[model samples]
Target chain A: MIVFEDVSHDYGGGPLFRDVSVRLEQGSFHFLTGPSGAGKSTFLKLCYGELLPSSGKVTLLNRDLREMTRDQLAETRERIGVVHQDCQFLDHLTVEQNVGLPLTATDRPLRESDVSDLLGWVGLGARADALPPTLSGGERQRAALARAIIGAPNVLLADEPTGNLDWEMSQRLMMLLIELNRMGTAVLIATHDLNLIRFAKAQVQARVMRISGRKLQLAGAEL
Target chain B: MSARAISSLVVPGRGQSVWLVTLSSAAMAFLAVFALALSVTSARLAATWSDALAQTATVRISAPPEEMDSQTALVLDVLRTTPGIAEARVMVPEEQAALLEAWLGPDLPLDALPLPRLIELTETAEGPDRQGLRLRLAAEAPAAVYDDHTRWRRPLVQAATRLQSFALVSLVLIGAVTAAMIALAASAALSSNGQVIRVLRLVGARDRFIALAFVRRISRRALYGSAAGTAVAMLALLALPQAGSAVPVLAGLGFQGWTWALPLTIPPLTAILAWAASMATAFRVLRGVT
Candidate 1:
């Protein structure tokens, strides 16, 4: 549902990537890997309309990112879930409140049962009332994931979702992403974890793309 | 979203403590009322000054006491003959003494002092020929000096006008400061709850929706504060000693009749100010977050 046509992004100094074209189709699983300072986060930001392409076009759901109004982008964001690497959460809010924040902000109907059930799914049910700052790194990541998917978005973009977690915690988080992919939510995750990629290769048919020479190059089936 | 959603989102001073909001509002309300009183009082003072001095003209004659009586008689005769001149009366010794007593205190011995005999003049709906009257009095009695009270009256009116202008300026400045303070507080609250805003934005919440959450909170707080302030101010104004019938200046300082309605609007005005300030700050902050 997201297409980047010759999209070149720059942070005012120089191009982050040049004339990179890619299409993320529905119900597909893709993993983007690159070394540190390879602009992985910036690329994901472009997909969500958080950062506009410096040149060319990035379109989401057939609408140009450059042409959509802020309101329209917000609406589009509801259809695309994003789990940030840092797991942004309001420190003052409890885990439940932080997860339910999207519902409150959008004036959506929220039920206590629905919140408990979602927390249960993410294994954060016991920590529902705990404040975000008091939670462990893995718990915080799960909470962020719960918040991202609470709106039932069709597309999920995770930027280093397991960056702060241990191997076991990362496996749990990756399994959740796989489950979402199985449920027909198009998933694109950016990371530098080769072990995680190898782990995913054993579970499903997934494509691997690497950032090389300032362009996205699709790695062969060896990945 | 419906008003119910807005109410839930705002929670009326929940971001801050209820007690703090109440205390701030009460203090602001208290201050606002006094500002309103001062503004209304100054406005009334200006109107009274304008009304008292507007249609009236005075004639003064400076002449020797021996020639004063004859000069007064001649001036009276000329005034009677003059077309626009209504009626002129010579001030009696007691009346002039009482006039001087108002300034010099009641104990002043007017008879011992060589005070000039003053003649009080009145004009009709159509005022008299001020220039012609002065010329006539000068020619008939060279010592006769026509004092039309313009010198003192002009300055008095100007001072009242300046007071009124100053009061209005103060009201505007107070409103601006209040708005700025509320906006700063809102920005801090929003930034502190940055993740909350981001989640809201991610969930399809429009900027206006986000802004309304803060706007409603500030507006309600401001309303409460200004209302309480206005009421206290009104009570303080009532407690103030009325300038007795003898002291018109003091009497002129308090709100009367329809003027009392003016202070009633201060609360709503403050609420509107808070809404505008919060909305602007919220939108600007949201723009940065996105």
Candidate 2:
């Protein structure tokens, strides 16, 4: 689980986001929505220890982000899988290798058969041998999702996981995210797509949190 | 980390700096082997040439052919009475001829030229007092001058000693150059793979884990390069012919049976140098970025 307490971040010019506290509990599905440049990606980065908060505290898996050593941060990352908006990957490697990267980093010896099964579950079994640049946008999103969950992390943070996909492909990716949440993995997805949030809410009992006026606020039922 | 995990960390043979580490390591190894060879040869030459030239004092009695015999006899008599003069005797014509045979032709007649009569003096445990012996010879055989061979031989020994020092310095410089080159290469590789490293860090790869990939990649290539250099150096050393050579410098180029193993240390030493360079560079760069 990850907890944020009055965390504020500034990118030199001024504070892009301010004093906002939130907690992501276990086995919960939440969707983070905000306008462009609303610090949604930055917030996700704070949860994963990629960037330190300007003030206040952020804790991941009970360890304070400000105090965690590099090794401890790495260990926390092993427990938290993240899907970037851009679906970053080592382009030279095959899709299977990219997906297995999480397991490799954690020294978790995953069998090839199990890796194949995971790819199949993500509908990427046939694209295993292809490189990231060669894959379609939808396939890349699925590949990123598969890679994020390969280590079976306790929490998953997805930043615009379906941003580049069509409605059909987005629905397919949402179904995969819903299935992961059902299996007791805490999921928080930050997106600007309102329809995507409504679609996801219908599939799973999901709470929606929106970033407004530089603070996190739970949306009302009317939103 | 498991071998599989470590192997997965690097894209095999994909780094652009691979050639830099390999070539630098090879260059360092080759220089190291030559340095070792030079040091060994210097030690042997210093011991042999220094000791040979140390305990020798020759008294050359130069005069007219008629007076040469009397002066030589008097110089020998004076040297025998002097303390620390172990055994003083007139050098044979053939021995004197042998000394000048290379500069002067072998067939040159010693009697025709007005050459000096040389008295070879071997020293006791405590060598003769030069000033006292010189005074006695001046009174008895004033034409005679004592030559200890120290002027020419001391420089030879000193030169060899200096050469040994130079070789040691060269070996150290080679290690430093290799480290510097590898560090530059490691930094370049890190900068180029910034995205890959970010992905790796996000997926739970520690700095040490990321560093291990670069270290092993650079070091393994260095090991191969150093091995090749050692093989080439061994062949080069063996190619220098030492058969029946009168020149001590040429003869000393090749090492003895067991001493030949000295050059073998270069490859492993270079491997360690590469490991250290890459590891340090990786950690420093990682700290800067992550």
Candidate 3:
């Protein structure tokens, strides 16, 4: 679980967002929607302890982010999965290798069968040995999703997960996220695509929060 | 994949930095071998000179031809009474001629000239007091001079000791340069592979895991490179002309007996240095990231 209490962040010029108080509970599904350059990605970064809030506290998994050591932060990250819009991957690694990285990085035994099944679930079974550079955009995103969930993190934070995908691929990726949420993993996705939000909202009980006027605002039922 | 395999895959394997570390380690290791050889050889030379000259002294009797034999006899008598003098013998004309043969060619005639008589003395472990013996020789044979070879031994030993120290300092400098090169290579590798690091970090990998990815690969390369360099240097040393009394010190620059095993340690030491250098660079670079 991630809780930001009255957090305000700035980058010298002015605050990107102010007084943003929010809590992402277990098994909850949420969408962070705002215009481009509206601090959605910054919110996701703050949730994962990658960036510190200028004012106020951000607690991750019941511990204050400011007090955690580097190793402790890394340990905490093992329980929080993240997917980026660009689908960051070690291009030299094969798809299956990248997917198994979470387990391997943590010194856990990597089950080949589990990795294979996860690849199958993500529709990347045929491309398990294929390198990331050789994969299509949609395949890359799906592989990224597989990698993020391989360790069974408690919360999933995604920044513009479907920003580069086609509508059909976007829906497909959303369905994957929904399926993951149904299995009890909390998911918070940041995006500017309203149709994707409505599509996901109809499928799961997802609340929509927007960043506007340098503050966090909960969008009403009209969203 | 195994943890090691996964770690290796996390970083791109080909880059200028890889070759930089390998080649620098190899070059530095090669120089280190020669430096080690120089150190060992000089140390041996120092000990040999000290031991060989410490227990011997020579008495030279410079007098008119009529009194040369009597003065030499008097010097011998003084040496006989010396407590630590084990053996004292007047050198035969042929032996004296042989000693001077290198400086004065073999064709030179010696019987017509008034050559000084020489008496070589071998001392016991507890040698006689040099000052007391010299005073006795000065009294009994006014033309007799006692020479302990201290003037020659002191300078030769000092030169060898200084050479050994120089070699040791060279080895230390070589190690430092090798470490610096490896660290620079590691920093370049980390900088060039920023994307890989970001991806690894995003996937919940700890700094240790990420650092191991680079450190293992770099250190292994260093080990291989230094091993090759050490092997080549040893082979080159073996191909040198065999050391002998006639050979110059430079020509005889190599290990002796068990000292040959010293250069073998260079490769592993280089690997350890590479590991430490790259690990430090990795952690420092990572600190700037998150």
Candidate 4:
């Protein structure tokens, strides 16, 4: 679980949030909605220990994020999966190799069959040997999702996971997220797509929160 | 760290920078192997000079033409009675001329030069008491001077000692230069692989894990380069001209007996040095990042 209490973050321009507080509980699905430059990505970064709150404390895994060392932050991140808008794969490595990188870092043994099954799940089984640069926009997103969940993390945070996808491709990615959520992984998707949020609401019970005037507000039944 | 641990995370596919690192490491290791060989040779030469020349002495008798033969005979008598003198022999004009042939040519000019006669003395393992021998020489053969070879040989010994020191210093400097090159190359490698590092960090790689990926790549390449360099150096050493009895100057220029294995240690040492360089560079780059 990640909790931000009165968190304010300034990126040299000024404070983006005056007093923002949010708590994400276990087994919960959340969609962070806001316009461009609404600090949606920054919120995900805070949850994964990439950024620190400017004035308040952000707690990760029941511990204050500010008190954690860099190494401790890395350890905490092992239990949290993160996906960026651009699938940041090692461009030189193959698809399957990129997916199994986290396991190498954690000293976990990688079984060949397990990796093949995971790639098959993401529909990247045939393209496992293809490099990231060779993949399409939708394929790249799917690969990023596979890499994120390969470590069996407790929480999943995707920042605009379908930002560059089409209607059909975006729906396919959304289905994968929902499936992972069903398997007991907390899911958080930050995006500006109200249609995707609406589709998610139809598929499962989800909490929609939007940033309005540097504050967090829960959305009603209608977007 | 083992090879399987890295699992080719930072393999040669990154860029041409890996090639540059390999070439640079090979070149440095080649130079280092030569420096090590030179250092060992100098130490051996210095030891040979000291041990062989220390127990020998020379006696120069510059007497009047009339007393020359008598003083030579007296010096030999005194040398024979001395407790530590193992053997003493007066050198005939022919033997002395042969010794000086390099400077004075093989022509017939010995009769014209008023050259003093020389007596070569071989001392026992315990060596002669120089002060006691000198006192005996003063009493029996006042015109004969007991030259223990120290006055002339000390300077040569000193030169060899200085040469050994210089070679050792050269080896250290070469090592430092090698380390600097590897460190710079490592920094470049890290810069080229920045995206890989970022992705690894995003997936929760500790700094050590991220660094190990690069370290293993760089160190493996270094080992390859060093092994090649050492093999070439060993072949070169073995192919060197052997020193026969006619060429005493070349006698101590190379490794003798078990010392031949000393230069073989260079490749492994170079590998260790390269590992150190990579570790240093990896830590520096890791520190600069998140």
* Interface RMSD for each predicted structure: 3.8, 2.5, 1.0, 3.1
lDDT of 1 by residue, B1-290 (tens): 33345434533335663334345556666666666667777667667666676655545556666776787777778778877766677778888887788789998877787666566666667777778877887787665677766786778878877776777777777777777777877787677667667766765678887778766776777788778877887888777767566655556456788978878888888788878887898899988877
Q: Kindly report which residue pairs in candidate 3 clash with one another.
A: none
- Candidate 2 lDDT, tens digit per residue, A43-149? 89998988999999999999999899999999999999999988999888789988888887668887778779988977889999998999988789889988998
> For candidate 3, lDDT tens digit of each residue in B28-61?
9899999999999899989999999999999989
Displacement of residue B114 (Cα, Å) in model 1 is 7.2
Highest-lDDT candidate = 3
Candidate 2 off by > 4 Å: A165-175, B1-9, B55-57, B62-89, B104-109, B121-147, B241-254
Can you write out model 3's per-residue Cα lDDT over A1-223, one digit (the tens) per residue? 8999999999888999988899999999999988888899899999888899999999999999999988888889999999887888888889999999888987878999999998998778999999999998888888888888888889999887776678987898799889889989999999888999999999999999999989898899897
Instruction: Give the winner by TM-score.
Output: 3
Worst 10-residue lDDT window for candidate 4 chain A reads A104-113
Using all chains and alpha carbons, the TM-scores for the candidates as numbered come to: 0.77, 0.88, 0.96, 0.94
Please give the ranking of all candidate structures by DockQ, highest first, separated by commas: 3, 4, 2, 1
For all predictions, the C-alpha RMSD in Å is: 4.9, 3.2, 1.8, 2.3
In candidate 2, what are the lDDT values of residues B1-290, reduced to their tens digit?
Answer: 35355454554467668888888778778878888888888887898888887787899888987888788778878887888888887878888899989899888887788888888878887888888988888887889998889898989999999998998899898888988998998898888889878888988988988888778888888999898888888888787767356754566575777988888888888888889988999999998755
Q: Which candidate is the best by DockQ?
A: 3
The weakest ten consecutive residues by lDDT in model 1 chain B span B3-12
